[model samples]
Target: MGQKLIVGISDWKIGRGDDVLVTYALGSCIGTCLYDRTTGISGLSHIMLPDSTAIIDGHTTRMKFADTALPDMLEKMKAMGAMQGAIKAKIAGGAIMFQTSNSKFNIGQRNIEAVKAALQKLRIPIIAEDTGLNYGRTMTFWAENGAVEISSTVMGKKMI
Candidate 1:
């Protein structure tokens, strides 16, 4: 193993060799992993929101939104020798942590939708996903093999 890179909320990290990227406590948020098997390059993003444009004020962290962060991370990955055509995606989290009646309050579902849409627009195929439940998740992405391990208190653990 090379290193353990911790991807915090509203952030992203790129890793290679035997490095592992991990993000914790995903509640109404999403953790998306992009991997290029040929190059053994992997990137993980912990996105807090669906879109930055939805914010009325421009004072927002670009990495906090799926719409902006994925592209930015992808660009950085390419710089590190990740080919766009060979990249595949795996996603987890987007849990509905709260009980809500209004659709507007269902941020988990909205985040999942936004992440899917963003990946589609970027022409990245999503290979697997575990999403849209009521439990929070912790995601661990292995750069050496492009394996995503999802763990939760309610749900045990699984690899995607």
Candidate 2:
């Protein structure tokens, strides 16, 4: 075990070797992780919105949306000597916090869809995912083995 890198909401981080990356309290948000076992490189992102372009010039962080964050993270991983073809993904979070009839609060599902589409466009396969529900989630990614552990109030703890 190495340092525990904490990825906050709308943030991301990369780790190598024995490092562990964790994101806290994902609800109506998505947590996406990319890993290459051979290189021992891993990236994790916490996205609050589906697309960064949707906001125009509005205030937003680079790591705050699926569209921009996914590709950017991939490129960063590649720059760090991770092979694109060898990279696999594990996604968690994207929980619907609230909903009502005719409400546009489907951010959770939309976030999941956006993440899947982005990964598909990047030609990265998602090996595992634990997503979509009414409860929040906390995710941990082990850079050494590319394993993710998910925890939550409702689901207790699980490995994905």
Candidate 3:
């Protein structure tokens, strides 16, 4: 698997073969991974916000929002020969790093919800996930076999 392809905040990666995609330090953000078992193609997106409609003041990156990023990742995967019908999703890292009281603006929960909504709209099934908690996470997606490995000091390691 060559060097691990890093999916930074507001970024996404897709590849086949033994490609590995990783995202580090997720806090109040969502990391969504998609894989096509039939083609051994995979994609991972690290989205920082729930939606892009709210940020209208200036030019904003489409990948920075879950609503946009998820679809973008899917399109990228399709462009790389991934069939939508054969794609399955796995998501990790939607944690409330700082618990708040007075508002419903829990970014983590919002991000998770946004990702789910987008996937649902696209008819993509999510087979596994680790989300909604108070701990940050780092995730890696293996393109060769469509496996995802998650790591976190608070929750140890898991492959889903």
Query: Pick by TM-score: which candidate is best?
Result: 1
Candidate 3: C-alpha RMSD to true structure equals 1.3
Instruction: Give stretches of model 3 more than 4 Å off.
Output: none
Q: Rate the local accuracy (lDDT) of all candidates.
A: 0.93, 0.91, 0.87
The sequence of per-residue lDDT tens digits that candidate 1 reaches over residues 1-160 is 4999999999999999999999998999999999999998999999999989869887778999999999999999999889899999999888888888877889998899999999999999999999987999999999999989999997789889
In candidate 1, the residue pairs with backbone N, CA or C atoms under 3 Å apart (3 or more residues apart, or in different chains) clash, namely none
Predicted candidate 3 versus true structure: per-residue lDDT over 1-160, tens digit per residue: 3557998898888877888889998888888889899998888999998888978776878989988888888988888888999999999878888878944768788888899999999899999999988898999888888888889987889898
Backbone clashes for every candidate come to 0, 0, 0
The better candidate by lDDT, 2 or 3, is 2
- Model 2 lDDT tens row, 9-75: 8888999999999999999899999999889999999999898876878676878989999899899
Model 1 clash tally, residue pairs: 0
Ten residues in sequence with the least summed lDDT for candidate 2? 96-105
